[model samples]
Target: MLYYKQLKVLFLLIILKSCFFAICVAKIGFSTKTPYEFIHPPQKNVIEDDWYNAHTDQYTCGAVHVSAVIRHGARNPGESDSKRIANIHMRIKDNIKDGDKFKLLKDWTNQFPVNNNKNLNDAGENEQHHLGQRTARRLKSLFLEEDMSAVQFMVSSAKRTEDSALAFYEGINEEIPSEAPEEFDSEVNDENLRFHTMCQKYINSVENNSTALKEYKVFGSSDLINQVLEKVIAKLGVEKNVLEPADLKTMFVICGSEMAVFKFSPWCDLFDDEDNEIMQYWSDLKKYYKNGPAYRITWEQSCPLVAELFTIMDDVIAVIERTEEDKDTEGYLLGNMMFGHAETLGPLYAALGLFNDTVPLTSKNYHEQKNRLFRTSEILPFSANIMFVLYECEENEELLNDEEEEDDNPDDDYRIQLFVNEQPMLIPGCKNLLCPYTDVREWYSDISDDCHFEYLCDPHKKMHNEL
Candidate 1:
């Protein structure tokens, strides 16, 4: 009878323990109904260039030459974005209640810093430093062999970009000081690096052209933006009638920037998956209309830089061809690396016909948007880059022409491979990432024809100039 009594007590204790656990969960509000209880970190899809290992076989033809155009690292919110976030915080503090969710929001709001300047924070600097280190490790051979003069490192005059370039250079030199340059080169709004900024016509067209920005308006007004905004505003405990889209957009930008700077911010958790999709689409609209395919001059504005890229590649090839003949020929131009803004990188990608969606992105296709290829976060994220690799290889004999020809020699072929954010980009006519240098050159040659600076930027020219 004593043993039976002890067993009953044990069972009773278990039941009480389960009840207590249920109570804690209920109080914690850890359920879908309480979606905003914890803020999610900003989407990392557009944050930075993720570091990756290059396959050993990737350099088989040898990374004899390489070039890159990259965006700056993570940064603090810009002037406009900063003001919006601050204003929203003030509003929240004034109106917040003493509820469970409100307390969490209040805690995060307290932690969020008030500084609203556009500069590289600690995390941003680290991103650039790590990019340099990764580049050094990947091309250790090239770094060891080439000096600063042989390798080109160029940056825009912006403070963050310059800092990022220096950080990258520091990473390379730290690993192998022998080939590192004592100082990196920076240019102030160089036409090649920042052509759009310098071109008044392009800027005016983007800002004032209603026809060009029709799609931006469509996307911004779609159910996507409205529903998401309504949901986000409610979650933030703000009235939609009280807050406007511009005000809300500032909050959105701040949320992403805060997540990047602080590693995690309550602002990030304001949006769920569907909300994030809407936000992403909204961002894509701005990027597209501002620097992408929204305007006619978008691709043409990037032509000057494309020309520069071609020149860099041709110069490197000239050296390679000479080295092949005389082996002792000075390889003065082995690699070229550039750091620029999204203003430069976005249109440049569009000019190159990369990341283009087969079906034009539109509000009517919101349901099919998921299948579209032109995602801004994927293509124009911080520290994003596109690399062109020039290589020489012994051609495959069996895969070669059956008819003997003097230039058909398998051993004399040169190859090129292109990578965007460390992933291979497939050219329309090229075989995989690796394609014949001649074919790649021809493709770029065609691009260069359409991207003439004088034709696109010259207001005096009889082209698409309304101003």
Candidate 2:
């Protein structure tokens, strides 16, 4: 009887081991597949009707400054498993009020598969590339025939952002010199320094909290808590980690010379205002940490949690219209490159007021052009707008000449026009010329259900003739 009992126990252990291995393999295999579905339709060509006779009507002989903001192009979807993991965790936490039960299940289930794809794929890359090219081409067509090398260029630090900038610049193919200096390598080094400083700050806070440290031990997993504790202890032991603080500091300076400086100014207020709400949810998640640090949730578990809150924060930020004061301040650039999953785009667009709003396009709208031209392809289920902003100095009346001088070329005039859905509309001019059209109404007499519009010489006349 004793021998048979021992055999049964061995058999049970083997079964458990096999099950654990299978789960691990399944999770690993599931994560490799694309998380989001890619949807591609037929590409449309730029219609000839989109080009209006701006030279005859609204062409201003003076220089004008323009700015634009646009959405990034389409991108690949997120990991399927991570989404699954987040959904399961959130669902369990929401439905099961019992703390002990939650912890018990969470600890056991945390190893399961969750969301999946983590970066942009081929379609996303192409979207950004094409969008940038189209935007650049359109800008060149509106501006003078001179090389665009003199234009000041700023881009976000994301992969897609950088790619978009490169593609756009290539498309323009003008010999214009870059207004900004090239410092890609140095800028990357500075970002690394900034990240290290943030990490040090977090470590310092952890060391100062004796009660929290104890709680961290009880609630947090041994693996993560111990790793953090080890790093803190090592920092206290030796000054070796202290590099040439001066040299390091110099390397880390966020300067204008850097190709990518992520200034959180415009969006900082949005994030700051929601700190309380974010912390509240974070605090709630702490209750489950009886087995691990709340903030230390794995990427798989954190993606959904972060995504949902981020979406809400985006909505809150979108309502904040830029004040006159904001307009006066120097602008913020999103970055030249963006990596990670595509879901990051939704909240970004929501914050920028790109969708679900009925703000009619007008002359004043062009003033906010810089914000309107920002674009990316990392976010799925959305199309990106390729907008451009051209800035020029105020005109000197003394330079004005009534007759076309022998040297003046009529084909090389400076005018800002927009091509929307194959319909051309002139943007509001500066102090030099009177804007002939007020809204889209003057261009398209018959209001069609389709968002597309066509140019009309005189809408009132067209209606009168029809009558």
Candidate 3:
């Protein structure tokens, strides 16, 4: 009787473990999908006073500066993807199995029109608008002035990014309802935001190199992925070899894109949890080699952007450390916001060593790296951003509880917090959300001092600070 009772308990535990694991891994992972599903907007916190999520222990005297790098909102699939969608649509008629779920796909015409690929759909626009509103609400101190001198903004040349910036601007005024600037900086070019495109080494080593995407390509051709593709074709009743890996990828892409625009998509039903994980790894591998830590040139090319961010921080620190009599505020700006693409944030994250996996990603380690930290669905989704908030952490009795007071240092007057997708990113050296500025600067200094755009991009060129 005791043995039977133990066995029953073990079986129930096993069932519960399986159910929990299923819920954790592989739920709709894609860049086009809104991150709000995975990371909820900080609506409740925005209404509160503290900069953090109601953790009032932070002794933030005032915010000195803020810098953010935001990716454009959800965009339509590219031209090639639209063609793939049409191709799959053409094949579906003779192949699709009849069911209530099949009703949508069978009667569906492709919503994507020619030349509509790069533009922001209505969903994309709304994402950025809310982001802007939230940002403004969270940092009200920066927008209180009528002069509008406190804030600066820039964007990539891409029309989607420009439109995103405009939407963000509109959202900001909705929150502050003040005399905000009518225009963002129109002169900041691709060299500042899309530096990878201009970088010769990045181009030669990753972007244009046929062998650069070897890992991603190899993974796509693996038995695991092939089996998934075979099942997809079988389910659709399409002929064998009719759908290539790229076409299957296009199916996933269309599913994510349509799901972002509309609340639901029939294309999404073609993929199961396992298929979702497989597709995620496939896309992540491409980003890893092309712009992540897999290739040195991938992150190394982001030198200029990193350098620019650190230099601004240095100026703010100088102001913070100055004595009351000798104080000066010549170069300090309250905020800077720049809008770019997925290419912009991926390389920057790598340069900062934010989400590096323990081992380099490979086809053999696909399953092993299932819990890897470099997943982009959470980091690079539509309207995703990486922001640095510098605060003057004046020593206050309120900041230190009885246990913390003994070790507190008055000299630690300034602190910094890095936010990713509107949450404080857990940096290795920092203890919590707000960390010592000096310790954070130590991690930042080497990258900032070493980057010379002309020198790193092309060895033959002389080094100069064009940034």
Candidate 4:
């Protein structure tokens, strides 16, 4: 009897081990085969139209300075990305057995426009034009007399960004023709705009540190993802061995890009709400781990940008403070424009603590995605912009009422308002959307103190191995 019981126990252990191995394999295969499914879709062109329609706030005190950090306008996919989509489309056409899914993909890919490079498309041109036109109109009082010298522009190294800057200039000229510079000094600094390339610490800790994002990897292969993958596989009538999540998402990417450019795609209807929510969570996971509140160093990566903004604002304030008697002072800078990619823009927004989830994003909390605050589609869409408007509010009403000659200074009354994508944003820990300049300055000063370039770049560095 004892010998028989031992044999049964050994057999049970073997079965359990085999089952565990199979589960591991399935999870591994899911992650390895469907890498693209987790990547967020490129910026949609329609977001530009949305911004144009958003109501602009009329400043009661008047805006003396405007700063805009913007994502470049819409563009086509790169050669490799397009090739992947094309291959997936061809595979679905040749091998997909399901009638509905096959027909849907066929109709969608048939209408999908082709582009082989990342240059700005016609829609991109219109998007940038609209941004400039709308911004110029809002600040029309400041630009009543067109003087390009009052404005400054910083563009990234990419050709698309350069073209975007030019397009925006053209748009401003549409309304205030003389305000747009014929061509002034524009700096192209990849160091400040593309800090990821230069920040070795960020690359090591966030980009290359596989161990740091183990939760993300586990979440990607969780039961929730597996169930969604199974649903997608069944919908397409393809065996698990033959089809992968990456293949399906590539079709989705093409569908979304086509729809954004041309305003419609049949493939958009292929996925139900469940599938979209799962895929969006996947993208959110990557973003959260790579450059968001989840990582301690993510915000530090954007210190240079925050510092530069303060420097510009300080210079402007110094000029404003110069006595009216000082004729040597050139008028304070009215506006400054910057154009860059979402890779940098996303991190900058993260540094500002925008859209942070109250609950931690973990595998255990994956089901609570609705409450997870990071939404890539809403934050990093094409032509997304973060604008800082410096307002000069009415100052010293008591003194004016007392019939005094006036001791009020615009610099003392200056306040800063934050706007994201043409809509006002109320910063965390602040009472209102419009915050006092001193409060903003103090907040940034603290960030600057914490942002020691050497320490941020090399968190592990130690002088005496002391805390």
Candidate 5:
């Protein structure tokens, strides 16, 4: 009787422990739905009569060149099966009994590698197609169908980038030519063509005199540098005899490398000082490249591009300046604008001067913009309109007309204006939090009267709404 009682007590204890464990797990995993919860709500409409009226005069003002640095459509960050394999491996390592068996399982799992595949998964493919269609439609509305063919194309070599570009061309029924012309060759190889070009330009700027190297202390010795220069020239495919100037206008360059390389590049190094700077940059870059660090290389590399993109505004201003000065050049230029991305658009936004300001958006906000931009898992998705304007500044005149003004008194500045999705918005004040979704949310809430949410709750009302 004593033995039986002891056995019953043990069984009861085990049962109670199991029940407690189950409860704990349930608590950890379970979540309650709130009344105001929304999965992915519809974004607010940005186009209004005010926005249309502002640009109405420019419709027939001739050709304009638009260069968009777009984030690629929706995609699984890494290989699709990575998570499943990781979960299984983690479980086996944690729960398996034998040390040898665990080692064997780990090796087997690790042996199956993950990489970007050209033939994207179902979600990626869909994103590509949808984005392509949307891009085509937008182009049709913005420019004559015939004009799209003339616009130069440059896309990153990543599978998604190519996929996005292809889908875009297909949607417009633009012929996918076998190859772009040699003059427009923007494909960057591993040999560092851009760096080499910059080096050559730097050398030429100094009149090829080695003594001039004293000015830029960062550059190494110039005596043997000529030999290095020869190698750089050969590697970059630059003919030493050719005297043509570097073509910086009307050319598109698409650079794609593992995020790791971008972090370690000289450009990133410039931002950080010596001592721990190089190591810190490498560590940060590697973290993003190895693990999923959300938007990494795209943002870091975009800073310089943003600085350069400002030149566009400067060009627009120059046209305005020319108008002010009564110069002979055409006052305006217009063309179809297209950009491709593989993931988050945070980098694109960062490169566009938005990230440099105070109070930038966060990664969470960026993710929200992703859902809003794609609206589906389809590849090659199109984002809302991004409008840039250059207004002529009088010697002492206010930058904006009273109705088109922005808060923070942006109108009082030099008058370079940027609009996302046709809304006059402020750039986030900080680099760390420049997430686009937060901006979208704020914009949506601000203009809620103009945007109806009936489509979010009712399946029947969820029809495609386009700009």
Candidate 6:
């Protein structure tokens, strides 16, 4: 009878434990907590160029130019986001009547000032500096010198972007000191980097339109909100409550922000993986409608940058063909570094035909689209970069006698490799990992022939809201 009584008590304890909501990991998506470790490329390392020689022994190659477009590193939440987060946290603290296990939340104080949000935090600076150090080491061949003269660096006018570029440049400076004759401008307002803000159609039709975000809003207000609410109540052990879906979003945002800065947070303990996914979907849907493939003009504005890329590539051919005297020409260039925002990457991805979902992401199909490609965390995470490494190659025999033979082929093949967040990514029309320059050019020819930004962003063009 004593054993039976003990067994019943044990079963009762097990039932109570099952009823408790266990905490899971916190995943903040593209907002912060970049997939790239900020200290390491979370993917396998592909930094060295030596392995390619084994695959393509017929041709000897070296990287002559590298063009990288990168997003800024982790930053503080925006002023509005910051304010909302503080407000929500305060309300939760106030409503804790009894049985609440929110010791950390109760003790946690909002030290981050409301008005000073969205600037680069110390952690953000560290991320950029580390990335720059890695970049200098990765492109050691191109970064062989302490000169920035051969480099072209550009950034959007945002203080955060400029801060990130400076941080990256400082990282490069550590490896190879900067002694360039001239410094690149911080305020070029280059449409290539700041295309979204410059385009009238994108600004008017998408950025300003609340109705365009209807699908995302529907998802935000869907059953997931209740799911998140239930989780928060169970985990917080709250007896009294005053929370809404918007407050939950603010909660998630703070969870991400705190993680980015402090590397951990108690707020994350309130969520399960599925709860986090719902929050991520809410943000992804917004990107899809506003900057992604939803509208035609949005991605087409990338024509300017595309035209510039191919032109620079064509200049590569001209570079090899020209005499040594032309090396000192006024406009001779070797590399370009542009730092922009998530707004920048989304449209560019759309232009390149990357990360497309077969069917649009909506409130109803969240579970079905679990494996969809438009995940911003994977593609547009903080400090994410798209690397365009341009290689000049020649037949092994031709390379052996290049200085002696003036009759070398001017039509020498140039190879191109694309890397996303430092992992090898193939250009859409390329045959393999390393693609011929001409072939890649042919694939994006529409950049020159079809897309003209002025025409694409016609202010008077009627906007379509349907996916």
Candidate with top TM-score is: 3
Candidate 6: list runs displaced more than 4 Å. Answer: 1-58, 98-100, 178-187, 238-241, 324-331, 397-412, 448-451, 462-466
Poorest lDDT segment (10 consecutive residues) of candidate 5: 248-257
Please list the residue runs of candidate 3 whose C-alpha ends up more than 4 Å from where it truly belongs after superposition. Answer: 1-25, 31-38, 41-45, 52-60, 94-101, 179-186, 319-323, 326-331, 397-411, 459-467
Best by the lDDT measure = 3
Candidates in descending lDDT order: 3, 6, 4, 1, 5, 2
lDDT of 1 at 128: 70
lDDT per residue for candidate 5 within 378-430, as digits (tens), equals: 11122323434333222222544666534343222233234553345555442
lDDT of each: 0.63, 0.28, 0.73, 0.65, 0.31, 0.71
TM-score of 1: 0.80
Per-residue lDDT over 226-338 for candidate 1, one digit per residue giving the tens place of the 0 to 100 score: 77778767876666565655654666676666545443445656766556666667667667767776555776787777877777777776777677689888665666778
Candidate 1 local lDDT, residue 426? 84
Error of 3 at 182 (Å): 4.1
What are the candidates' C-alpha RMSDs?
Answer: 10.5, 23.6, 8.6, 13.7, 22.4, 8.3
Model 2 has a clash total of 64
Clashes of 3: 0
Residue 311's lDDT in candidate 3: 79
Which of the two candidates, 2 or 5, achieves a greater TM-score against the reference?
Answer: 5
Q: Scored by Cα lDDT, where does model 6 land?
A: 0.71
Clashes of 4: 0
1-467 per-residue lDDT for model 3 (tens digits): 23323444553453355457546534457643534444554364566324522223656456677888888887888888888788877777666655455676776666766587589877789888888888877877656563345566778878888888878877888877854345544436687689887998778767888888888889989997898888887777667756777777888888777766664566766777788888888888888778788877677777778887877777777765564446554546777788888899998998887888878888789879988887877777888899988777655566567786533554476677788988778666777877777788788777778877777888454423111
* lDDT tens readout by residue for model 6, 1-467: 23323444553453354445543243335333443462243323535443223125456667777787888888877889877877877777777755346676776776566777377777678777877777776777666653776677778778888898888878777766655534535544569888988888878888887877888889887887678887777666564357777777777777766666665556666776678788788778888887787877777787887777678768856765674457764444566778888888888888788887889888789888777888777787778788788777776664455455442554446788888877778788776777877778788888755766776788897755556
